[model samples]
Target chain A: MSRLIRGNAVSADDWTELDDATAVPSTAKVIVSLARWRAERETLAAATAIGVRVDNSADIQTLWPELRDLPLVALEFPKSGDGRAFSQARLLREHCGYQGEIRAIGDVQRDHLQAMQRCGFDAFVPRDDQDLDDCLRALHEFDLAYQRAARDDLPLVWRLRRQA
Target chain B: MYRYDEYDQKLVDERVAQFRDQTRRFLAGQLGEDEFRALRLRNGLYIQRFAPMLRIAIPYGLLSAAQMRMLAHIARKYDKGYGHFTTRQNIQFNWPKLPEVPDLLADLATVQMHAIQTSGNCIRNITADHLAGVANDELVDPRPYCELTRQWSSFHPEFNWLPRKFKFAFSASLNDRAATRVHDIGVHLVKNDAGELGYTIYVGGGLGRMPMLGHKIREFLPEVDLFSYLEAILRIYNLQGRRDNIHRARIKVLVKALGPEKFIELVEAEWAQIKDSYLKLLPQDIERMKGRFDVPAYVDETAADDGSYTAKLAADSKFAAWAKRNLRAHVRPGYAAVFVSLKANGVAPGDVTDAQMDALADLAEQYSFSELRATHDQNLVLADVARKDMYALWQRLSELGLATPNIGLLTDLICCPGLDFCSLANAGSIGVAQDIFDRFEDFDYQHDIGEIKLKMSGCMNGCGHHTVGHIGILGVDKSGEEWYQVTLGGSAENDAALGDRTGPSFSRADIAPAIEKIIQVYLEQRDGAEESFLHTYRRVGMGPFKARLYAKVSAETEVAA
Candidate 1:
């Protein structure tokens, strides 16, 4: 179950898992990643998107146009604590206007979905081991913000001070 | 003190959201640990040995009593019951959870404060002479320029990504209490024969591994060109500072590599282009900023008020002693600057309790202009208290156990929190400080011994700034045991110099006795009480003190030799 919790309001879990054995059509879509690829461009290019483990922030610009055109771009979280990707995500949206589904995959905890949402992570592929229902509750950590992100069209602080 | 304008507020508010997003992504696996550590450190957060620690910024060490109370409340709710003030005069909370940081920042925001640039490779909190407006010796208040530097340096486009942390300290008077010589940039506010408020800028000074005093490149940079001159120096350093090794990343290293003559030439080259830029001072804006610091009005008083104070002074011998030592004369006729000792017996040198913070705020409101200043020597000050009110204020402060009457005496020591809080320290400085304080509790006896500057650093990194103390003690590790090293004749003034090493290290138990021996030697050989401990040591040298330290009757007679 995977339902969105917007702001402080929590919604019930509603996402269903699709089993690999049950999936049938050739046109069926599934999230593929860098780790899942067995070979080079011959096989890896068949996936929806390619996730590069960015150490420094310079890599996003190098791979921008391909990622911009990809139908599904699942950004890999190599570890649970690295933050270079947030800047990368911002560059994709603000600088590149990346409109593809920016899915957060790997080590995705329930407590992190809301922030991932704000940083333009529209979808998430939760780790297969964690309970899916618990991950959705991670969204409503805070209902307010002082800055704008990809989630909101206007920076809240600008709005407040402009009115002031 | 300059209050935060709308621009500063918006910057911090946005930065908070930025940190929140960074924290979120790191948790969800979009970001990694090492990268987040750097980002979190930029926001002044560190995961300590026990829990997360937060270092809060006290801009130029100027905070109102009300602001101090807000810090006190934060300590009570989000951290342990107390906070440690560093040599740079910032406060550090030993216990804070990573999850509550946003809330903690919000709490600080209510008090017009945040932990911006307290750490990381960015321009740090600007510092100035703690006795800024009230000190009689000062020609001009350094607070306005410090505030200007604070705003200019914050979120600097290029300097934010400097190789290592940067610190800038300013001094406007003869007595350089700001430790200006040992900062990244030490600005000495000076006046030419014409009485213009110019600055003598010293660049590339720092104290970590290779402690170097800054070299002056510009002698009388007028007030209008101060910003341009500073910006020139920063830009050069940002471009040339070594990035290969973190230890070699400071501006000192850059300046050292370039040498002083080359450094000055490079700075001048950069400044020539920006001398007329918008960053250069506008006279009206300077006036606008300066207007924020107008002195409080004082009423005329006669010697009759002085007579009553004299009677109170006569009635309480203790009060007389405290008034003589702890009180400083102000430039105004009926005003005095009050010294509040943070170094009480058994407590850490700079630890202030929540109760004390509240009391200080009350005292500031009732007496001074609701203002307080944190000195570099780990003392808080009420800047403009009336002379007539001094006796009553002293009595009230005495009730709070703060009228120590040991300012600049043997007990007026600077100490670090060392092993008790800092993970990088070699020894427990607070414990040694307590032991020394208990040993020298008799104020009269301490006063009789004369002014001795006893400084302790937990480690060689010099956050405790032991290198510039009159009697400097550096905690060292030898064979897994904590030992203390002694240095003699250091001073932070017009003739500023680093102390010379005394001898081999002493064990934890031997530290106090070692200090005692040095003082004992000073007492035995001083020319007079007028010659303070530092002067006597400078005249006599460390040889006499070293002889007295190791000449002790060792209880080992060939048992090991």
Candidate 2:
């Protein structure tokens, strides 16, 4: 069983990812690939607790408008160096206004947590080799950041000015 | 020149603590080698050919005297008694133990300097004109904007892990001293038709295996929209740049593939969405940032030229020659900017000893208002030297062996740390530079050659900026033997252009002599002494030089068309 760090705690993942061939459960919380969700849109839409797993290269504009009612969106990293997901995550939160859980999956490690969190990822599925505790601690490595991002709309300069 | 605030201090302090822990874990065998490599690279630590090299960012080439003393202290105490100032205005220590780098970084943090994003796939140290606030021809100082960009790009969450390393250079001078056109994002501070200050942004220019000039994306981006516009460009690059191939991963490749028009359209669309976001710069923000770079207290009552200065110039030919070559026109009356040449013969281009660093610190305090700037040519500039003290400074510099009197000559070439220290070099560049220095030992002959930029790179990586050199040299390996390829007519000026290949490569022994042949052709073909090698090469094309270089056609197999 895989565990994910959700809201600063290592929690057992209740959601199951469904492949294209897997039969959709009638009432279970399930995640489906973008392709599967597109192919069986009507069937997946009617089900309770449905989520979509978007690949790093997928066009988020095509999926965001319809994802208004979804509770989860799993973004893929493929590998840690391929960082298209960071932009995708920001676009979903800042531009598309998707407030549901944006979970980072695939190649998610301790080092990637801080940056991922800043880009609006509230949930993370740690890599199998990494300890969940270590990944959680990595999120707090730096107490502050320099830029404005999805997590904080005001940059450090503006915040400091306000306090002054 | 921007001092760190409490927030800035906290970020760097936390970063040091984090890296220290990361180092401890790596040393304890808890962290994987590949994973640690990525982490260490973001902090500008690299396992090089000999030892771990640490590059410290000197933001926009500006350094205070106290910070310089700390650098000298690091050089003396850490590994060696010397450091190399790079073309991007950063200092690299070529021999530091991996375990000791954390301590070195801690030492740097005390002085408000860090190695953050100096070498990873992120926005690097934002560079600006070395003559930023001092040059007379500039429309406005670009350092404040550079500082803002530096802060914004540092630890940027969404853009840090890009497909390739990004670089930014800012220039406001009439002369493109910062080499903005060859950077990932080049910002030129310009005034619009209504006399309102703005930026002309250039996108996708770089100098690696495939060299390309940046395309002008925005002719006039208003001052308030700087960060928003920059963020839009960076976001597009982060998401869309090719990640599968390392060589073709730079933003230049993406911009080219999409075409400038299409790329501009995408950036404009993205900018339209984020124009009024929090990333937008407020007027007060710009004013506050500018306050940090406030002009130094310059002496207002000094004479334009004293009798003693004129007498000294008339008396000493050597002092006159040095002054002619090294002095730049300062905007402040009675003050002249002095370039301390690091390209002295028999020395590596930018390597300064610990003793020299300390002495230069003393000189900066005594002569130039306690500030120094690292130039793109790998030299140092005392930006506010008084005119009356010129002779005295020259005499002192002469004693220190810094009076090389060859600022723009052939001997003053840009050579990368090739096979000597770099792990990626195909051939050794320092030895070739030494050979050329030996050949052009005559100061008068070098003066005749005029302003010819001779830049060399060890490989196709182009860290030496070979593509923009007027006489560019690229080292290639031929069956385990070192060979050199030559290019002519490259310039990194306002009208930047990639150098054309002269012909087939030359052997290690033949490289210097081949350069002699090229210079010989230039001397014979030039209109007069007033016409520089670059101008003559441009006017006549590469035909005469190529004809001379490949005259022994039987010896060479492939000839450039």
Candidate 3:
């Protein structure tokens, strides 16, 4: 029952996140844990508009080939200081070329929103009690970036040289 | 020095604004302390023992005269009228107010300086040989590569919060003045047999509680694949480095745990996938970065033995002594690099007063092409002083109390700001250094003893590089008292090796006398005065020094009993 910042604006979250042991409802927008997705792969593959949640501990490379066509992939940050999910989000976008929707869930705060977005997290379910407006404002904090990420096609070095 | 472009300027400015907002949020109690601690540390703000210490990065230790003047002004206006230059080539104000750090950062950004990544669990400042562009034996100037790495590592999204703090050092000369062997990643820029530029990459070297020399991973990684290789290594470390224990989280431990062979395999596996990415540096990109570091103009004159210079040397023996010690051979024939000793008697090793800083700024404008550098030994350098202007510069520097003729002598010790300033320090380092200096106060005795690196660290963090000193002193806490453990034969040069610990630890009062006794052994049993303390220690093993130190300690204990 919370709003998510999806692709630069607040959006109504229609998806229902099901625990690993929960039963998947037919024709409902549902997100399941990586374990549940793997355990019920053939059954969940036939469902409509389904997503999978990958924990920071799980390797995103293992979910490839079968989970490539999912409409949504939510990466979890178990702790604010643990940045393993930032790499996972980049691997999903740049490595796997999954272009549907990448959401950042668990421990997401205003300080992490911009970097998370640059690494290809389009939807953010911020940590509870953080202001949504502040998280949105964090996106515009930096106008220039030095390295190339999933958001920028070319690095600032190349772009600056081209401009000159 | 690399000049910032419009993009670089804007990036720093925006970062300042971002941190300002973050500080506001933290003050408003919206952001928790744990979350704000990580952000503040990345920007080089530390809540220290007495007050907040703000470390401002001097990229590759290069600074313009204007920047030095600004630092002096900040020291005068913000905190006390002094600032401490660190071994990482950054200046730290130990008494800055917590709320005023953002404004101080804004002031630094005006001078094209920022403290970004100076601390925290990310890549720290990319240090180079202080004599980088001016060194006679340098293969290539390391500043360009350092700047490139700095930009790549700044605000890097994935590696921002690594398992522990990472450090990188670059050296291009035969002598490893940058201490490359003691860093997490040591890049030695070299030209291959084919006359093409490449790098010899070393990984897993670090100094702390566990000191291990870096293992050479790749002997010839091409210049173009530098960033890709670095990214590959960092990705491996980020994913695999230990996160359960903060003490064992540095990449060195991971490299040791997996062994260099397995670590290389993992990094190569990762590199095979991402080698073709946009992180690869193009020739034009290298050229563009190099263009920012244009060489300064030099006069075409040889360093002839002029009558005036000879007469000055003959007239003042002190000037001759200072010249023999403080001057280094510059790449330019007529010029010499001057090492301004910050380790004057009784003063803290790297602490400089505002007046001294302003005087150095003025001197840089007058003689050294308006440029200065902070050496890793916590000293300042005027890198382009002319041979003819040497005497005049020495006279002026003497007037400022900076003309100490102990550049590489026994008294030129690198001592950390220990318990006086650092909250993590277990004992006082500067007090011990002062004690050693008082014992060896005679210039003639110091010159006679010759070429001994006496480094002291207040704690096991080894910021003072005590592990690699020829005579290393580590401050330990024995219950509630400060005790020092001495080591022998460590070096940070091309033949880098960790020192072996001498017998048992000594009390703070007995530490200096124990060192004197060790030096006494070297003096008595050396081949000649030509043999340095290190060479002598190497030739005759540590047995003699250990025996002498312990004999004295036993006699003193027996007398007390």
| Model 3 misplacement above 4 A | A42-47, A153-155, B302-307, B555-561
Error of 2 at B89 (Å): 1.0
Q: What C-alpha lDDT does candidate 2 achieve relative to the native structure? A: 0.90
**Ranking of all predicted structures according to DockQ, beginning with the best and ending with the worst:** 2, 3, 1
Give per-model CA RMSD: 8.5, 2.1, 1.8
* Candidate 2 per-residue lDDT over residues B513-556, each given as its tens digit: 99999999999999999998888988999989988888786455
Model 3 chain B poorest ten-residue lDDT run = B300-309
lDDT of 3 by residue, A56-163 (tens): 866677777756988999899888778888888887888888888898988889898888888888899988788888788887778778888888832465577766
Off by over 4 Å in 1: A1-164, B303-306, B553-560
- Candidate 1 vs 2: which has more DockQ: 2
The deviation in Å at residue B2 for candidate 2 is 1.7
Per-candidate TM vs. native? 0.78, 0.97, 0.97
Winner on TM-score between 1 and 3 is: 3
* Residue B473 error, candidate 2, Å: 0.6
Summing lDDT over every window of 10 consecutive residues in candidate 2 chain B, give the lowest-scoring window.
B552-561
The better-scoring model by TM-score among 1 and 2 is 2
Candidate 2 positional error at B134, Å: 0.6
- The two-chain DockQ for each candidate, comma-separated, is 0.04, 0.76, 0.70
User: Candidate 3: what's its TM-score on chain B?
Assistant: 0.98
Q: What is the TM-score of chain B alone in each candidate?
A: 0.96, 0.98, 0.98
lDDT of 2 at B454: 95
